[model samples]
Target: MPTTPRPVKTVLASVTAAVLLAAAAATPAHAQSPPLRDLADQQGLRMGAAVASHLLDDADYRRTAATEFNSVTHENDLKWESVQPQPGQYSWSGADRLVEFAEQNGQQIHGHTLVWHSQLPSWVENGSFTPAELTQVMEDHIDTTMGRYRGQIQTWDVVNEPIGDDAQFRNSVFHRVLGEDFIAQSLHMARAADPEATLFINDYNIDGINAKSDAYYELAQDLLAQGAPLDGIGLQGHLISGQLPQDIQQNIQRFADLGLEVMITELDIRMTMPVTQQKLEQQARDYTQVMDACLAVSGCSGVTVWGVTDAHSWVPDHFTGEGAALPIDDDYEAKPAYWSIHEALGGDGQNGPDDPGPGEPGTGTCEVAYDFTSQWGQGAVVEVTVHNGSGSAVQDWSLTWERPSGEQISSAWNSLIQQSGTTVTAGPVEWNRSIAPGGQVSFGFQTTHAGAPSVPGGFSLGSESCTIR
Candidate 1:
């Protein structure tokens, strides 16, 4: 019988879907993009990181999903029990809501796991079942869960952590009865159910196909030779600063050589408890190296960190004395990790993943919309309106720009700003002016752009609200 996994919170929601448009803004005058941009933008290494609990409630998660990432995976959203609790009884509400949320946000979804010994429901592990019965239960679970997410999830961890660091399979019930065949069987079941979905055998300890990775690697190769359904190998990269096993990239490439798409799933760099400057810097270096590996390989899909913010990380809960493993801080503030990823993806984080996206730069209670209308070479007049919905004043805010060409900012209106590489800064757009609850005010800027960021969706006004036209 599978056991019920501990859930952090309710994953169900009634999400309203709406279409949105982008506001046209004149490109800032005399601005240029960074000359030394990271290779990610050109290669399209889709940006993503796991989210914290705060994101689940605020509209930020949707915005984060839309702008920064092309694909989103449940940090703990798609655990085994969340899908199947009792035999043949499946719950689609939580996972369904997540899928809807991802779709509305203009992102793709990845199924976390179809089989994991850790989070299995109680019945599946202890329930009365013979060898044949267990296999049937396994088959049923895969068919139902994968069938529901069939095409929506581009990749599914058909089996997660099937073996320990030792060469043998872990002591899950499946191992006791179905024996080592459980892995091959589970893969077959998931593949049969969702042939279109990419099936991956995911596990940690394989960052650089070491002994543990090799065991799984050999297993995967043998299965492929026998014509089993295995699409990719997911490298669970939970590395510390400066210590990504030397062969990690080579391991990933080696797996790719076996004719499978390689993904750096669950990639995060942790540090000693109170994060130090050295660790943070090393974290940045490690992150860049992983991106280098992905860029070096041809079939690398992309990297997905376990979570974006530190608030809801699985590290503190699971790994002792280790914290701050993700890119952004709990408040969704940009850390070195965030900047590293952006630069890696050709984004000089002047104006980051839409102000409305989760893990974005703004505090999304007050509505702020800006309009830029001017010639490309002229100082543009951008009008910004700050509408206060909640009883608060946006003490500080700023609008920044990055040009497409390799030019730099020679001048700016605001002095309290700093320019980074090709990114030009203009403000700590301090609204010493306050907007009373339900009141509104407007502000403007003079700038230039090679082009404007597409507000691909619409202006997310607040929770359950959008300014759709």
Candidate 2:
């Protein structure tokens, strides 16, 4: 769901298995190269592809998918709308087709999603069911679909894109009726249906540690604390040219520290169309960077690209002027990005999982500088610059400091603020969640008190105490 511009309109067509293997004979560029799956297996990774049922029919596409990938995620066939279009009624023909292909090809089936805000059926969206009724509807869908595919699939994106960039829960129909608990409830239901399937909360813009990711981090912690059935975090590595977030490894590490698995679930780097060789090379580097980050973190389950070829890439329609996102182009030619990833996975029979792999940036301290932007009478606007004094990157941050006596935060911007006595905690909003090495983001708030502006004392970012100014 790499920031979809519009909804996917149709379920892909079905393809025969014979066509799948035949594509290998066509031998697109890099046909001489070793399969990506073999290289990934050496490193204990599940190299994956997001597949539409129809793509399996194209000889080259099918050959590449079945040969190069060890895992397959249904691009759209497994979603709620595609599976259950009406109340209590279900359809699995499309999803079954993909599952059968994965099994036939000896690939692990990674279920795309069980619940998502978009791609939901009309009944679920327009049926103004009460909160209790909607809860049943959601649980029923989970039981029906997940029950059908129980042990067949390895993972399920139980909840997807639940948190928006604003660092707040998205206003999906589920949220409208069931509130935040909807998330935990969905996970619980999914777990009940498929006890063996790994359950994940997946999102885009979370490939790096940032505000939106921070929100998920917080939610994941809460869910775990409550003993809710959450398993992994899916980093939808939907990247753009020259804009890879710098803290990918750190982000993955922190999530791993939480004892949850992580996966680069849907990765693609889109650039402006009519592409150049330089851009493709850059894209290759970006793809390698992502795979490298996955390798650095122990709990990272694997990496899965969004699609097999650019011809069917969603970029052209979703992102105007942007295409050529996949490693393979429309004509089944492997781009530089393909070889870059191949090299990262140890290239044609080179290194194994024991290798230290590539290096990653180090972490350091975070510091904050505060100032009163404007003051008049009892009201003053205060801004604090949270600097990533750390040599590495700082992901979704929490800034806490002690306010002067009787001072109260009236309102805030660029952060989520909470006050308990003189201690104030301001976490990032969506925009300012991450700070690259030496980079900084500032959040401001209006305060009311009897005296002129006064500085807060003893700021801290997460557990790291900051030098306050």
Candidate 3:
């Protein structure tokens, strides 16, 4: 079902400037918004999305992908059918364009699917060959593909969807001709081609402790015992709204126990069509749940949403009466899911586009407003906005507050934060150091507390007492 890739348009400087101007006019707040990639980086995790090569021509699509994600995956361009459609013939233009885009944007490339049962070229699927010849063909494919991008691709799905719902190996061409040995062989060949790349076996429906996951767990143990080169397990979290697996953290921890990294790959929470406000809200909570599950597990490295926006989501074509599976709308507006994910990644957690932020207009020289953006059993995200109500601009402002006993500040963003004993001081970073007379700057921090979170008071700006709201 892969579409033919269109010629990628190289964005000229003039067009790029125009696009930026148009985008700013359309959504001015986005310019000051902290990107998801920055928030995820603060936590030592990556936020990624799958990219359709054809969509790179769209300015909005390209801009969102470049700004929001730290890693990129080609949706179909790197598949066997897309890359090699004929015997001894390889097409690299579409794939190369995506790689170039990722490199230019400083994003890591997750080379998808060196081997899979689906999306195979007709020559590979319909060819008549003996087991030895077929094995040679597979090895050659891996060598050529992996060798071409050895150091550029940080990780790869060496084999994909190898196990079935019935907890047995699928009768794929590789499995049918060479039995289960083909998986180990593919891993070995991939390692030989790119020794530094992290190799993974990816699949769907293994996000929890189900029979399919059990099968993979056993298979991984056996492969490692036999000295196969395996480094990670990819759980494709293509889930329905409100149906996230309850034991997601446990499952990730179990895989981590195997001494292999775990990643939530191909994540999308789809719902029935004619999307409603309630459905969208539920989807937001579901997205936050998935982020929380990943953040809770030490071995879970990152997550990759399947596509950039609902306009480009594949759910409608595949699932009848189901759509709206992404964080951005068709018009390039941020959905509730986007804010949920932002807060989950330790952002300031402004409610939505219309949110006026923390406080009303004040007559005092400086005013501070504090709000608890998100709270769980033991953790909370707090946002403090510093309003510059003075007639003149405020330069290089610093704020001080006392931390409540038994509360611990884990991480913060948009400022330089430090604590000694019960007192905490925060100063603006270079980009946010100056605030106009009527402008305000907000900073957030994540904290762990016992019982309910205690609010810190007695705020001061430089040597002046500030009005609190």
Candidate 4:
């Protein structure tokens, strides 16, 4: 059911789009204008896109993705047939290329899938292995592939599209062979392969409270009780024109309360082709609402659009007569949805009255937020988000924070970390160095502790100190 109002007729010219693209490219890196990635960073969440391996060679597509997003998921290259075409044989060239590119750009790589019903190689799809035999095959596949990437990838859609809208497990090969336990077994294998990576069960049509998502919630609770090593749930936010999920926040919060981080892993709103002004406006509002929902929930870690640009989007091919599903258009220009996301992220360089904490005396425009993803008897994963409220983009950022007396910074992700004595410095990698006005950057670290873990205070970005909240 549609929840928002339909848009009035609006139109845009090609010339205007060209101008927007020029302005976007010409803006100096240090200017106050920030990209969507910067905006998401300020909220302690990630903004990402799904990229095909071949698209990395497209300069225009590559530039837009590198600048606007902090994470990348292989749209298809990491899938079954693409990676392993023959039994006991593998192909790593395509997947590896994207991995190297993401590493060079300081973008986090999200392994799209380890198990999926579609695109399976003929060998695996046709092999008439017994239930016990098939379980071994699946386990071997997970172990071999996950072991190759190890800790380089941050998250894995360990099992994808598992549940149908009818609230029952889909008739996928793994499900047929191993029955209900395939989901749990796959997750455990992924965790064993990469102990640090976050394992997620990803599915589409789970954007809001419904039969499909409910089934996932129930299954997740069961898995957790069985100690199945599930850490997150991915809601593929593929929406149609004028149709927004009304209970998005509540749904995400419910899963979060289950001790799992939720992600909008593949977000894009599709509409009729030859886009109209009204449709674009509607799209903008839709994108804003989605980003706002994630921001409102402490457990929502990130949002990933299905594609970076309409020129390369899968919507057209996948949905007849429906296209224009990305923030960037085919002409390499920013669309209405781009500004909508910007507005939602507070990219206007103004610190709202609701800022979580106060800024330093001279740094009136900065804010900081802190939270723990998980904590246990001897260790904890802490998330830190730095918001830049200045009028110009920050090209180079350096933050200083003291490590708690007994806490040791064991590892960090999404940013570079350095330590000297008790003082720890964190900075953006090459890809995340620029912070737009009112934008932010988020990073997390695992700490080793002898006693109960405590949050670290006294944070600063560059010479200007931040108000730790």
Summarize candidate 1's per-residue lDDT along 335-375 as a digit string, tens digits: 67766766676555333211221112234455555444222
Candidate 4 least-lDDT 10 residues: 1-10
State the TM-score for model 2.
0.71
Q: Residue 448 of candidate 3: its Cα lDDT?
A: 72
Tell me the RMSD of model 3 versus the true structure: 11.6
Q: By summed lDDT, which 10 consecutive residues of candidate 1 come out lowest?
A: 21-30
Residue-wise C-alpha lDDT for candidate 4, range 1-469, written one tens digit per residue: 1111112122232322223233233211222245666666677678899876676555456556766777899888788888888887889888898887676455788898888887789888777889888888888888888999997898999998888779999887788778999888899889888899999999888899998888999999999999999999999999996899889999999999999999999999999988999999999889988988998999999999988788777777767899899888887667888777777776752222232322222344677776665565576656677887899977778888888888777555445677788898877654467766777766555566788887677787788877766
Poorest lDDT segment (10 consecutive residues) of candidate 2: 352-361
Task: Give the CA lDDT, 0 to 100, for residue 361 in model 1.
Answer: 24
lDDT by residue (7-43, candidate 2, tens digit) is 4334243343223222323333231234577568678
lDDT of 3 by residue, 1-469 (tens): 2233322334333324334323322221242355687689779897999997777766667767766788899998899998888877999988899987777566888988888988899889877879999988998898998888888889999999989899999988988899999999999999999999999999998998999999999999999999999999999898899888899889989999999999998999999989899999999999998899899988899999988888778777778899899888777677889888988998765533233343465667888877775566676667788877887877888899999878877555556677888898888764567767877777666577777887787788889888887
Stretches of model 4 off by over 4 angstroms after superposition: 1-32, 349-469
Model 2 has how many clashing residue pairs? Answer: 2
Top candidate when judged by TM-score against the true structure: 3
Off by over 4 Å in 1: 1-42, 51-55, 349-469
Best by lDDT: 3
Measured with C-alpha atoms, the lDDT of residue 241 in candidate 1 is: 77
